[model samples]
Target: MVLELHVWGPAFSLPSIDPKCLAAIAYFSQAVPKDAWVLVASSDPSVSPTNELPALKNGPTWVSQFRNIVDYLRQYSDGAWDLDSNLNALETADNTAFSSFLESRAQPLIDLSLYVSSQNYWQCTSPAYGDLLQWPNQWLLPPRIHSAAKARTAHLGLSALDLDAMEDQRKRDHSAAVAAGKIPANFIQRPRDTVSKLLGRTSHQSQFRLEALTGELFEPLEAMLGGKDYLVTADRPTSLDCLATGYLALALVPELTFPWLRDAMKSKAHSLTAYTQRMRHKCYGTAAVKVADAYPSLSPSPSPSHLPWQTPERARLATVGYTLINSLADNTPILSSIRAQNRLRQAVESSKADLSDVEREALAKHATGMKKDVLVSVAAAVGGVVALLGYMVQTGFFSHEGEEEYEEEEEEYEEEPLEIEVGEAPDAFGVMGL
Candidate 1:
């Protein structure tokens, strides 16, 4: 079967600005059979199911969204490259929670960086759209996409804070330049430009939303990552790892014009940088060279740790706990209902002596049905907890007894680096003759 992925053309010397596009590339690189011919193409809104790029055509079927594309591929391949196959119930829950967190929190920052940031838009993003469109469309579409992106960032509260920060910094810099005799002291600063006024309307907001989001999301991600080879405790790369790798690889590029966003990403725990580099080497070979070329000054040197197919370390209990809590919170209604019912049952049992026969029967009938509900809920909860504990124990989360063996195997598995070549052009469509 022929599988084709449609995405935005690449800009800023990285892959697509859309994180999902990068994600689709990462997923297919590892998931599909090596011999399978999957074409990645650049597409406009007209061809997409939701008028968005990153749509996938699998044989005669069309699928949109990264998650849906993945699901379709899994089903088509009969569960080949199923990243969550080995995850126990708790780990699965943890994966789902973390994925949702990344989507809601980190993804917006990416959109802001690409489309909302003035420098990035003019220099990197708009030109990308221009390259894929014909004449008037080249002129017409970028602004619309930019406007939509800005609207999205505004909705998420990222655009205003960042724009204000940029405007404030620009004013400061201009003042400093004048004080140092860099420009004529008598010369007045230019009035606020259109972009500035557009983006800086809410300048009074005290905190930087992007910084807050970065801290809120990256702190836990960094802690969970630690020194592990992948995001989860799996022996091989998983879908979550693909997503994390794609988002980080694209975000951490030096050429991105959002100074605060770039600095914030760089300030993340060193392991994140390390993991991105490792995944880049493993999943994207020659493509890494192009991305590095975009930011020659900040390009990382090749490291021995870029070896592919090494076993991943088990996740920490702290990471597991965070995942569990987030997952449980996501299911708050079920848990809350269960708790309320339990309390009601306790009250009814304690006050049984004071109840009339009719009241007793009514309470007993309610209790009988609740017992089944409670049993099912309790069973599910207990099973999840027990599976998590079992996984923790199996991985030696609490001890180092078998760590030496894992280390030995890790050493033994190291070999000549395997090269998985991403498309030559940053935009896969260009390579596919789209």
Candidate 2:
């Protein structure tokens, strides 16, 4: 028998239970054959229709507890189901519990669909959810990089409030409460201490600063995902995959409102945030009703400028080049020789120490050549890095000395010849083992 798995979280916001919510349910329900058993699991008790547990009465069951859902699902589908072990898989640490759940749910008889509460459906589907599939090689993952580092227009806004402002506001609120005899000075300090202790911070200032930092970083995240449904191979979606989209809606709202949340995200951490925003735009049709690419509707649309992922093509090209250079250095031998020629040309152009006309022209020609070479190297690099970045993005490898090390290595490599094996290659006739 086939088993369908559904995941739902508690209701707290507009995204908690909505069209995407229903789509998640239906999407997963249809992934498996009709003959399979269906199981719905929700952190929220009211996820099922008529407010009843599907697991208790329906042929397909609804389970409020994650462990119970795992137990029931394991019975009907051994190799077909793919679920994260945690009650709320998306909420688990580093998504490890979720990863374990997916590995367990893999079987031949179960077909999985997801009804998730978060907006990370795009990620959960491919690269993320795809990691746990019985045959992940069969799936086509989306673009792993979210273009966070790509060039684009910078529109600064007061949307971000500084730490000083937050502190002053808190102080003002505290003073007002104390003056009104609503609470003593110690009352405010007590909660602050409690929070500090719980969070493992020594002082309220440190904890609050951390919050402010997180908020600052995630502020630009919403703009990263304009509108675009991140499909898991355009049509099929596995369980926990849809949560990638759901997690976005959950994260975006909070990131927009809370400055600290933004600050908490750093570098590639922004990629996850960016991915969520892009997925929401894909599924929900921008900030407003999405007019289908094939249809025309007079719905109130979101601003064309207020897009989620709008990094320009040229910028994307540059980033692709940068990532390529880095990855090639790690996995290939030709990378060093190629980077040297490119860097030599760059040095000639940037050097303002003065040069004769002959030297200048020679340098100019060489730089021009390097630019073309860099462009080509970058293009070839794009393919390799896509695989690397896709995995890193999904598994959370954006943070580390890896990126920095890559940059330094590239810089050193730029001093070498960009063409290592070219002179060593035989004629186009492919003659001998020279």
RMSD of each: 35.9, 30.6
Model 2 lDDT per residue over 1-434, tens place: 33433333212222222223433433333333434533333322223432322222234544423334434454546645444332243344534443333323221001111111012222232233233212211131122111110111012211112222334567888899999999876773522222223335434554654444344334432232233222222233334344444433443443222223323443425555666555555444454322121011222452342211111112245544544455457345456656566656654665332478798789778767866776787878888889888999889777777888999999987876567555565575656534
| Model 2, C-alpha of 371: deviation from truth (Å) | 77
Most accurate candidate by TM-score: 1
Name the 10 consecutive residues with the lowest summed lDDT in model 2: 108-117
lDDT, residue 12, candidate 1 = 48
**Residue 63, model 1, lDDT:** 78
Please provide, for model 1 over 1-434, each residue's C-alpha lDDT reduced to its tens digit, 9 standing for 90 to 100. Answer: 55666665455444555677777767777787645634343435445544566788766667777787778787877887576678888877877788878778777777777777776666676766665454444654576677666677777655453454567888899889999999987787766554435445544342355667778767788887877788877367778887887787767764744455667766966777777777766765545333222222333553322112111123356644554463465358666566556655665675324578788779877877876786788789889999999999989797875888899989998896989988655867877899
Q: List TM-score per model, in order.
A: 0.57, 0.27
lDDT of 2: 0.38
- 127 in model 2: Cα distance from truth in Å? 36
